[model samples]
Target: MASCSNSNELLSELVCSVCLELFQDAATLECGHSFCKSCLDRKWDSEKNSICPKCRALISERKYMRNNVLSNMADRAREMQIKGETNEKTQIKPSDLSQRAEVGNTDHFCKEHSEKLKLFCKEDETPICYTCVDSLKHCGHNFIPLHDAVSIYKEKLTEAKFPLETHLNEIEELQEKQMQRISEVNDQTKAMELHIKSEFATLHAFLQNKEQQLIQKLREEKERTLKEMEENLRCIKEFSDTIQTQMHDIQSWLEQNDALHILQNITAIENLLTRSQKNFIKSSPKLVKHGITLGVYKGPLQYGIWKEMLSVINPGLTSITFDPNTAHPNLELCEDFTRVKNSGIYQRPLTDSPEQFSLCACVLGLEAFTTGRHYWEVEVGQNNSVWDVGVTQASSNRRGNIQISPKNGYWTVSLRQGILYTASDSACEALSAKPQKMGVYLDYEGGQVSFYDAGDMVHLYTFTCEFNEKLHPYFYPGLKGSAPLKLFHLCL
Candidate 1:
């Protein structure tokens, strides 16, 4: 900073006043004013009197002589300014070295006592002078040599660093997953936007209202999903920032070696480290399940959304509860019609209710599927026991043992001995995979019923038949089955 100021001051002296440039063919006029020889000559040629161009000072003669002494001074000033700048940047000032050296001067005396910091008080975690070691403040504290204390703390610091670094790596991995989720959201929203616009184009002139409605729904979903994800991302970012701050503090503390200051701050660092080691990897952003309902776009434009909804949209997931009036004696109906488990002994029929299942340990959902596409999922938790689950004709036989097949008005699948069995008139096809959550999709018009592994949408089986009777979702918690089957939470 000082070098720049001096350079400007020197340059001002070297420059010719009239031209504002370095002296060229430099000469002095009789008025003791310096100007370039050509400038003086141009003034004499253009003017009627021998007057200075800058102040209009009268000169004794029209002739001007070259000042060799003043010219040399100007040349030297420019050279010195350049060298001064170069040296200022490359060479360290004495005061700067002194200032920097003061910070790392641990080997020196204590700031308070002005005596050598030879002893380290372990309890306080700081270096102290001999006077401090003997003082009442450190009466019961254990003291060690400065060098030994530093060595011990360094090892401890190294031990702490390994786990923090591992946690840092996990935080990075979580950040990466967060980004992937963001990209998935972006991709899904883009596809939805394009699909909506294209579908609207097909119905261009007739259904502008419907088009705007669908597009508006798309915008709402985009905003809602992104808002949730951004909030999650923000949480992860806040956690990351906290980890970084703690890391920096620990590093600074480790480098300082000031036992007194270290003692004052060590507790915070330890607490931070303990917190960081646990729960370092937070919940990253994930796409909301059933975030948007398709009814907004689907009611008016059925065909366009139906096929797409099959894969992307969770449509018409009706909330289904078991009907106690239809439960068999052996089957225990849980509260809220969500779960069922089999008991060993079968109780006698409570009443002559026609809706009750008299023979089998099977039950029916409260609502019957009369029309439209309906979807629902049941949690068929892990077990090797026999269990039956699917849709059944509402008026199907509930009296005696019957083959659970389409011909018997039961379009269903059974799990027996770790194998999946779909019943038909021909024979049951053995399924390879066992699903925890069973998804059932019923299309009354298509006259089709299909099942899936709800978690991944892996197809299990499809039953083809013409439905003339009202259908109800069915379940058979077999006598030998141990685990309870639960209906998944579906929208109202």
Candidate 2:
């Protein structure tokens, strides 16, 4: 009897503290404590920090060494204790112990009737024997075969796990996409930074301050976007972990063959599924990284700055004059070649030159610009019934009837009858008012041509295109207009 008690004490020592079960596949931690390998692993995985379950020591490295000696001792102790043998040095293999554990106990019997519990009592929420069904204690309770009850509960658990599995998959996919987006964001930010730096490096000295402002703004935007993406990733991971734990619990419940145990807390399980469904709907995480834009930094950026610089620098307009050689027969130029008008009759001794306009009463500027910025003004009579003033490409047609459009390498604003119209591929757009003193500004490298009312410098219209050839200032004094088109004094 004393030996049996000692044997029980030895068996207790072999039991793992975490699971309170005889150690199976035992593992030793760095802290010199032992536990069932699966128990230790589950504990560590569920916790944020890894620590020894017995000693409470923080585990720096997760190395689980299999304790072969302890495992063999635990198997021998469990086998001898179960078989009521008091042999301390008895040899028992792990497989022998596993086979003994696989053998299940007999079905439980009702204490009062001493009969097998084969029926489930729905009202009492427990298994009862056949004799107990007619007893006054269970007189009015509903009952079903134990097998049927197990089947029903297991089916319900199985059905509930499907949505949880799908929800977990979606969250995992979102996590992968979010990680990819983070990498892409970094690449895009670096590329944009280089582009901005190169652009600002070419700008004037005064723009150094503006360059710093833009860089700072870009950094702030990147920080904000990354923060949002990371937060979304965290949320997705947290929800994914929650679903995984719930599904694990449900699977365990479904694997149970015992009717009474499987049906226990059935209402709580249904409530859990309901909560998961609601949370799945509400906890949808999205990756939100808005694209950064240059805003005012784009589209006629340099031109706008140059306009601002004009006030401080006080740079004057460019000096430009009409090329009389390119004038039509009926167009007469002033002695200074600064003004032109369409005379009623054609001049004698007709000269048909390639540079001359044969049909339209138009004249080209003496200067041909292929690069840099140029701004010139032309004065038209306030009540001029018909006139055209803008820039045209040097290669454009100057002979016969021609369409004054961008396709023909011409960009002009004209007045027909009494309304002002700007030419385009689709159709001509009418302007609210005509500019008597018209300002035509051309940015060769910037790919922009803008017109303004020279009187107040109010912007009128602009055209953007890629320039591949030399450009010339064009003028047309309508045949029916009373006033001539005259050039303004030059300023540089």
In terms of lDDT, the best-performing candidate is 2
Which portions of model 2 miss their true places by more than 4 Å?
A: 1-116, 123-126, 129-132, 135-141, 294-492
- Evaluated against the true structure, the overall lDDT of model 1 is 0.67
Q: Summarize candidate 1's per-residue lDDT along 72-186 as a digit string, tens digits.
A: 8766654555577435543333233323233234345554443567888888877788767756678899998877776776667667777777767777777777777777777
Q: RMSD of each candidate?
A: 23.4, 19.8
Computed on alpha carbons, the lDDT of every model, listed in order, comes to 0.67, 0.73
Q: Per-residue lDDT for 392-420 in model 2, tens only?
A: 88889988998998889898888777666
Model 1, C-alpha of 187: deviation from truth (Å): 2.4
Models 1 onward score TM values of: 0.41, 0.42
Error of 1 at 256 (Å): 5.9
Tell me the TM-score of model 2.
0.42
Residue 480 lDDT, candidate 1, scale 0-100:
50
